[model samples]
Target: MRNAGLGSWPHRRARMAPKREAFSYDGVSTTYEEVAVRTTKLARRLEELGVRPGDRVSYLGANHPSFAETMFATHQLGAIFVPLNFRLSPAEINYQLADCGARVLIHAPSHQVEHERAISLDSYEDWLAGGSEEPLDVPVTIDEPALILYTSGTTGRPKGAVLSHANLLWNTFNLMIGVDVTTDDIALVAAPLFHVAALTQTLLPTFIKGGHSVITPRWDVDECLNLIEGYGVTWMFGVSTMYADLAASPRWPTADLSALRVLLCGGASVPDAVIHTYQERGLVFCQGYGLTETAPGATFLEAADSVRKAGSAGTPVFFTDVRLADTGEIEVQGPNVTPGYWNDPVATAAAFTEDGWFRTGDIGRLDDGHLYVVDRLKDMFISGGENVYPAEVENAITDHPDVAEVAVVGVPDERWGEVGRAFVRPRAGAAVDAAGLREFLLPRLAKYKIPVHVEVVTELPRTGSGKVLKPALRRLPLAPAVSPENAPGR
Candidate 1:
């Protein structure tokens, strides 16, 4: 085998488990042998199109078997795979295409992306049919880059995080140790595959373990619930919102979810109400925390620790090193950590410490041998000379039965330097009010820590990655502060 990267996996798994099911999508199942054959043919076709080693190949679409096949095929030719968020506009999509200098753009018909060399997934089968089925044994090393995942760009422009084969492999190894993925596992990939949480955490690990992956193009609460029972899915990955929607679904109370073994949640902290909903159904969530640069798996809280250490991000993965700086910023160093950003030396240099640890730009604290992520370093606000983390407050507020989602930001205050303002979304039919929310928080939070102002909104602006767009929230018109001393009920 000339390839020492992920390109070798398909063929290796084919030999080990030729008849084992690898992926299931839209009622069609593919075996390891079949996947390997498709991968080889696709690699040959890509090579014929002049995709050389070190060339960038981009994929734009939702969750599909083609996503996995294209990733493996691109790696098979020793090229890098860049998965774009389909939700992005044509302009944003083109910006990423040009940023990566992608040689070929393989996209779905739904996306209106423009590129010089584009291959529509509509003609994907015909494209592969023309290429021979012979194996492509490209000489790829562990240090060679495999993926260029872009950050969410909440504040500034998104930077491409270059992850090597080693980084991804070590991340998978860490996940195997942390979650114990097995061959009998059937993972439901309901989340978008473009995100590292779904790709590196669920899809790749399941593939490495020879487990079957059931991919849904996009998330639909009812469809996911039905697929979990129909396919007997053992495990799956999702964000906080996805889990919340599942719990809110009408079928949730009677859905036959006995086949589900574990549900992995990340992208944000899971609220106490959401966790309790799943717990009441005899299922526990395994929460994780990381960035795209860390191959997305720095820490994972096992199901056993979900209750005792509810809000903690858990300890670092087996192969990662995690520590807090003097300023409470989380620093990570490990094989799974990315080397640097792609083609941006200035950003790359600034991303790491002088001694080489990647500065996570996230504030965290260590307690009881676990890491609790407080908030983004820049997101923390000082209220009345006291520091407050929005995540901590949001977590507490979402615990209210009527509250579905909440985002807190520091609004300018005349009394205090800056006070917290909560933008809350109530449950579907609930009539939750700012006064009721304030009363609910009276016992749960300190007087100074509670939001001085609250606004009930139908929705909060969010980024493509499901993170609340705090900047947008900050731009909204501010209301006069309601001081704790002179508030309506205080």
Candidate 2:
């Protein structure tokens, strides 16, 4: 039988050790039995709110124990859980809610006022007060949809990816065997639970292992360090930017990270220098690559291969097939793959190939079984008839000694059709100029591949998960285009 819900997982854990801690946040802790009771009550509350089986229930909140409880509760009733990005604007959240045809929205009190209309779970005591605590009859099949995660929509409007219970369960089990998670493990969940990266890599795996989860309210570097020490956090997941901030934080080096056994970084590529910095400190750093469509974990560079693979996103997880199309697009197929986009039949049809492989818009190449991401296919542009991948130029620029961060995008060019433009954040206490950057990258990149313009900024605009918002960058007013000789491009 497939293990997909609390009914089976909780019963198995209760027989093994019901008293063991299953989750912790702030000072509150919940065991398997406690989780079961709360979820049962919440399920009843959801039913009282008129949420029937297969109905979409939206959640707009930060990462907390309640979020996980609510997700499980929704699952118990065979309802689809749509966790909205807490950082998105109300309109963005509303778009997703309406797109999914959500029947009810359960939000935390902190975010209740922010949402135009939402039922606060913090005030749910009154609602559940009169409701029954008995578990709702769960008729969930392995193939039933469980989650509707909206993509970041970097290229266009976001699309909700529908993930089945089997997709999550199988992915969680795959992560367990691939990462070797144990019951004694305590996972530090710093990434937003709304993202599939956190949900699949940390939350689901922790529950499946009967392990403890330390939920952080937000991603504060010092607070994250403190939580690691406070809860004896054994494993954690963060993006490359988070790791960079943590490594450069004042609390690091002095902070006791001895309890940490693994640190997974992804959502974007990691700098080689950053990887070396962690290795020099005896930290195990692994990198992974996936999209919301793949239940967020298609490939993972194991700790053992971290140094060897360097910048690779590692091999595909068990049962997942990762292939590079002849056109250089990444294609994925497996049980973990999402069924399709919600209410987007045209997009759903366009997303898959003739044989059913999902065409990931990413451009990548395989070197001895390891995936090296070149860039996003959509992010690539032709400059002076030469193909320019923004990620490549951005990576090169970020590697500069005085550069702290960078983003590369193509701008409308009346002469060349399009030209590469770079926005950079220089390291503190260091001096960097556009001319100097041009000189720095001139030898490292092709003549046409070098950015035609460079702008220094305090920081690049990013999503909550640290992905560079190139669309926002594109909206900025045009700057003077520079040529290879440090003059106007022309």
Candidate 3:
């Protein structure tokens, strides 16, 4: 009972609700008592593998019960857990494994990591069964590092954000207070748990409440819809794109969604159309705004205020404090915020202010007690002496029925210092010409704010967390300035 970190949660939950279902995957369910036993066995195995205090144990796989088990086991031995994005290439994964100096790596089948002991998830059962489940009560502290999550490296190399046990616990408290996850909740975890939002924002809080979680390895529109109806899911978390896909599904009109009580959305702004689509079905989204550094729960837009503050990210969470710099950059200070980046002293120093607040590089606005994230400060550009935020323009463009997705970036212009160029992916069977997009924007945005050029694309590149890779879009070759009538075809 000396463990004060996340590793202690499994046993704690088992003591309180031993028979309650903890998590389910692929039609199999595990109880809290079972999870605690497995966690102890895994911890002992890891300890035998030379994983000591402060050592790192990395996990590379999809959303499975083993992920949570490995994380708990790692922390139980007073070691740091590093969860790698399975979507990344082997080279990328190797960099993170080396960067963190991982002692052991638990990965899915066919995935390889150059570590001393690489344990495949296929053999995870055998691995767990071999270890003796004798009691392991390592003395750990709340401030000790629990996770090292890597940032989506859009600009340069990805840096690991070191989150302490206190940060994770505070974030869980904030989410519980803001969204109300109860013991009766049946949560659907469709997002990848490797991402901070899915892990801390969705799974951890539900686990703490002793709620049941239906975990999926990957997202499939029909599969998710079926799980919701079959399991009578009461709570779920997803990004804007996932929600949009669900709403666009053929069965959306007749799908059984009456059991769903809470839908938490984040990672990007939810288009007004997507919001209306769900509202017409008698469901309201509880949208939040945050980054991995803040344990990913800085603000929450309660379902009650969702309609009133349509585009706002909502107010700061219960324990987090948010402030906007004169330049509109969002700064956060709270127990939930990460202490700093792993092994990068220079980047850590640059990420925080002299006084201690973490500088979230993104720009935002405070209005009527709500926070509206305008755009990334680096993403904004001045066009003809007027500052332009792509998110504002993108939101306006998404209103067009033909558009499925769009990304705007500033390209060098001959007349203006810089001009907005939009890359749009049209909805199925929609032509979505540049002229029509311009005509649609004419009434919605200022002349300066509208994208000067539009190009129809088949798909937009996105990160594993469902965020648009703007840097990739900026790297694309600029198409010629075409007249609306002569716009290129998709």
Clashes of each: 0, 0, 0
lDDT of 3 by residue, 283-389 (tens): 87878888889998989998789888987899999999999988899999999999999998988998899899988878998899999987676676645333466
Q: Is candidate 1 or candidate 2 better by lDDT?
A: 1
Question: Which ranges in model 3 have alpha carbons more than 4 Å from their true place?
Answer: 153-155, 379-490
Ranked by lDDT, top first: 3, 1, 2
Can you give the TM-score per candidate against the true fold?
0.79, 0.77, 0.80
Look at candidate 1 and give me any clashing residue pairs. Answer: none
- Candidate 1, residues 1-490: lDDT per residue as tens digits? 9999999999999999999999999999999999999999899888888999999999998889999999999999999999997755464567788999999999998876778788888888888788789887889999999999976343335578999999999999999898879999999998889888899999999999999999999879889988999999999998776787788888889999998878898766666887888888888778888988999899989878988887678999998999899999999999999999889898889889999999988999899879988767666665533345677678778999999999989776544446788999999999777767778877655455578888889999999999899999999998765445633221
User: Comparing 2 and 3 by lDDT, which wins?
Assistant: 3
Give Cα-based local distance difference scores for all models: 0.85, 0.79, 0.86
1 or 2, greater by TM-score: 1
Q: In terms of lDDT, which candidate is strongest?
A: 3
